[model samples]
Target: MTAAGYITDVDYIPGFYPQLAPVAMRHVAALNGVVPPRIADGFRYLELGCGLGRSLTTLAAANPQGTFVGVDVNPEHTAATQRDITAGGLANTRVITSDFASLPADLGEFEFITLHGVWSWVAPEVREQILAAAQRHLAPGGLLLVSYNSMPGWAHLQPIRGIIRQYAVLRQGDSAQRVREALAYLLFIRERHAKYFEDNPRAAAYVDGIVKQDVRYIAHEYLNEHWTSFYFAEVAGMFSRAGLSFVGSLPVHTNFWDLCVRPEFQELFRTTTDRLITEAHKDFCANTAFRWDLYARAPRAMKSFEERVREADDIEFRVTRAGVTLPHQTNLDVVTSTVQGPLYQALLDMMSTGSRPLSAIVADPRVAGTPPADVSRAVDAGVALGLFEISARHVDTATGEPRGPYAMPNDFNRAVIASDALSGRAVAVASQLTGTGHTLGDLDAGILNELVERGEDGLAPRVGARLTAAGRSLERDGKPIKDQTEQGVIMAQACEAFCRTSLRQFLQLGIVSPG
Candidate 1:
């Protein structure tokens, strides 16, 4: 085993987390009444243990103004990330292969630092090194995002982890093979009506969920000897040692009191402005199993309401898709409520047409007279509830034309399109418009490649050829279409949808362009 007690032989998956985007981090901070790194001047970003660099490379490509760096102990991870950086021709991002304690001294400070799966899966010593890195390098007012498995929810499942890990050690081969054996043994036990599974149905169901996950993921998740899930208060206490204060959690709604817990349990939070207490209480109510939490090295609360409004102006929001009606009622996990009203209707109306700055949406004549703060809250609520989305303005608000220099479907995007078309990995291509990755399914990727090769022509030929070569069959309604005419009709329908929906959106996001 590695000295750090991490899973090193099997590499982690390539995944992009939208919350790690610089624009998203800035918005979450501002939404919670904190001043973030100024957007106009740009900022530096770092991801400790950045597995495969999907999030890192995509964000760097999406945000030209921001410089990005990724550090991971795994050389394979760094090598793959660097391959994308070079092939995608991203000059704004770099990756370093080094464990946390031995990070290069020349590496400068970062305005944003994030660690997604690292916190709960490393040795205590490695965690100390992580904190040491943050204490030494996090710039003033910089945000640090740490996502990990949390307690209460994982409490019942702790025995489940132990059983798998124990089973793994008794078997042979590498982490992956061992995990497969362990998973099989556990499933065998559950199927035999073991007392533990019989007593805890949720845990039994959780085992079922585990078996369906990727073997690579299961290996890395459970095989690590240092796996530890933490309670919120305990985690906060540790970050405090590194001079970081927990500000708010992600999905935006977590920061709001009314949106955090059940309506009946809401009384439990009314007496506390202390986030530590509220977070613990909120966790118990919702039994939140995992969290994407934001913390700042130097917590800087906005000094005035005007400053908060100014922050909102730079952040933009829009309906997630065209014709999205505001839900008459909203549910934020355990918290459910009736949010329909004049302001909500006005919000839906204004954003339905295009992405607009929070200031602009709240200032519209329809939503006017509503307090800007209240309006901003509503916008955040919609985002949390999946009613709206956050984006970068790709057009001149006044001129109704493209604004920023459009360079998407670049060398990097081409490689992604080619890979995703065949792999069906659901990985995203970089987007300048959203300042994040835009993901498409296998068929959409095929359609995009066709558009890249030859636009507005017959579809089923090239796309279907790619599928057949990849050993995949073209299917409709879960049944393979062997007949050419039927396949042509289905492909035609898919072509219409790609153009009407995803293609149009991709054009706005600059993920693809006219060759």
Candidate 2:
């Protein structure tokens, strides 16, 4: 092992994952009627193994009231993160280059601690240190978010992982080259009609998919010296040692038993009763390969069913997509369900003007007779389907006034939008409303940047000129338009769509103001 006692030569890729956002955790907690850690403002957040620190820096930009710190053993990663922080003018964030095992105790406590795509890839000693840090640095009632590769689903892929790791060790090259060699070795074995590959068709298919994936991701996932996938029960046990209790999964839909497991296993899950055992059984039922879990120093008691319904009533919902239709289908793991008809349509209609509290949605004339339970289920279904989003910002239960985190544009999003004017490659924008990031296409980002700078009148001309300068011409019916006049016409149409659809989403997400 290197002096750091962990693999450092092969750095993890820089990627932004919205699942790591504190708002996502709070949203899930709120859905369950449990009080989440107070992260609305003035919260200290820490991220272990924060590669490139994209999520942390973006979050810091959005929540200037909060303090953010990221720790990574790689100096190169830390340097890149520092550069990003400086460029974004984020004063509330910092990155440290140090192994988890040697993290300074004097760094102070944090209310929100996160480690994404790290636990299953690091050595056991490193994991021990991480848990130790959680026990020591996590303040009372703090939340710990950890994501890892989980089992039963990974059972079919474990042997493939072993083969790749073994082959990578013998190859001499950079991490990407080693990943290519390992994938080639697997392909060679498959070509020979190896008994292992013949016996496991799914494993062969997984190997085929891995061959096509980015080598950087492959190297971090498979080329690591130590990697282990855990069962849900096993992970729960490990966290228990650190004085943390598993609250629930980040995706609110995962907490709904009926939505995750097959019908046949639902009865078994109900009878199991124990949360840990039920989670494990659900994993087996769904063949779940990955999990984003939330743990707390002490789990708060959930409100009674009626009280939970009342709490849910005060929360607001917004349709993320414009002109969303019904007959929505939600597929989580192996479980799939379809939601249709007037109930969802009415809810969508109510949100068309702007975000409305669920109380208003439940009381709407069109769906006034619908049962509260049905409304809740449909809302959850819509959220899982990505047609609707539940805002982290809460409303005062009595007065119906906005409470908790209020939506506002932030420096990080402005920086991202400004950067898009030159690079035009960013695919996400930070959403202050949700305390998370939202995805947008390169064209949409370019148009938003131009609109921010030049306003509505200059939007189409700026976008068309940018596209022309980039050697990109608009396409229609699978054919590129090369004529200057035709290109301008298409660009105008594209900008109009952006104004109608993408711009509305930006307004809802708090990435930009309506004006």
Candidate 3:
């Protein structure tokens, strides 16, 4: 380990990231004209700095055949994850407390190696060790995902972080308490309208976001001694030295050049044949603060439009759990536009039943007359617009009041559902069929937890009781619903919606099973 140990004073929060899933990574790779590791024969997975192993264990439950390992320097994080692994019966995963420099040689190679919160927060020497580990353990043709706080986006926020860290040093208390003090200091400065905050409304607004984050997250984020942001070209150069080349990016949408930049920036992408230049330009246009980049040790490049389409045939897509209507519109950070018309409608109609491979989608008669490239473009835009996903099952977009039939949720999901309300966090539940975690609302999880414990009888009231115990305000029109009758009515309504929509969807995703 580096002389400066990670902030052991506060344990890092566990997380479940769907983008790191093998199925999702493969989908992103295939979209960007690179062949991804095949998922059919099972694969080995590793996570560096897997805080609390939430994602690692959840994924182990989701993909039972895959071997999983997580390494973290903090014993608290590893020990917590071990509890979940045992609780969830996730025997496929193993957690070790070790830094990147001296990882066990016998740990062997992995088809997928990922590090999310580690890269930008560690020292230069540590980053070099990370690359060394990746080069040593990433199998040829395997993919490695590295997510870091990116440049340009973090550029303005750097000063805020620096001040917070400096102020934190003088403050007295544990890490979380110091974080609270530092944030109080930052907010006090911002409230006075510091010249920096006054000049940058975005940075000012960012402080409010920090205020809302979990204190633990704030501590790890702002208190890290080596926290640094990198430009795309520089990070790419570092990865190149490891014999790995860039495959693609995450959120899936970022891979689509046109979707990544606004209209005026379209010409820049069309003019640039080199992908590295294109990525750098996109970040500038979108002001990307963070990025999830995929690198492949032996990437098989797909150069032509036809070749990419042919390779993409094996890739599958589905209507996102949020569902889709053709004229889908969203106001996202990068760009926004309304998506509609025959191709999308055809795609939606085809995926209504379940996920379908691109080959089946294009060959379907509903979209037969459309060109293959057009179908690919629509899928890309749909994914970017938040209307689609690379998934294996379909659930109606969230609607209705939740009600239910109950067999217990999977052990992994039950662990999440059982604890989420109390944890003040709603980590997504694992879905075996999708090889991903399905997002669950807090109220819905509470209701599900109630149903599991007490059955549907008086379920709504029990869920309300849990909510009340959690100090939740049962409100109406932004005011607390003061009448007992009105509160009961509101809980009943929410319960109905969850049962009809979210509960049914959970059934399909295998978050819950049929008794």
TM-score of 3: 0.93
- State the local distance difference test value for candidate 1: 0.81
Which stretches in model 1 have alpha-carbon errors above 4 Å?
1-3, 326-331, 394-408, 475-489
- Give the whole-model CA lDDT for all candidates, comma-separated: 0.81, 0.75, 0.81
TM-scores for the candidates: 0.94, 0.85, 0.93
Poorest stretch of ten by lDDT in candidate 2: 395-404
Which candidate model has the greater TM-score, 1 or 3? 1
Misplaced by over 4 Å in model 3 are: 1-5, 303-315, 321-323, 392-404, 469-483
lDDT (10s digit) by residue, model 2, range 1-515: 12233456766665677777776766566565566676544789999989878888877765667899999888988998898788778888999888887887688998889999889998888888889999998887778899999998899889999999899889898877888888888999998989998999888777768886778788888878778999988888999999998888856678888888889889976577788788988888889999999888876665554555444343457776556667777676667877678887888887765666656666778887878656766776677667677665531112222222222256676666665543534456666556666767677777877776666676788888887788776777857777888778877888889776666556555577644
Candidate 2 lands at a TM-score of 0.85
Candidate 1 colliding pairs: none
Question: What digit string (tens of lDDT, one per residue) describes model 3 on residues 1-515?
Answer: 54254688888886788878888787777777787776666789999989988888888888888999999888888899889988888878999988888799898989899998889888888899999998999998889999999988899889989988999989999989999899998999899999999998888998888888999998888888899999988899999998999988988778887677899888977777787889999899998999999999988887765776565454567787545565778766767778778777888888776777776777789988888767876876777777877763333333344444567657888876777753556667888767877777677778878877778899778877777788875766657777877889989998888877777777667677656
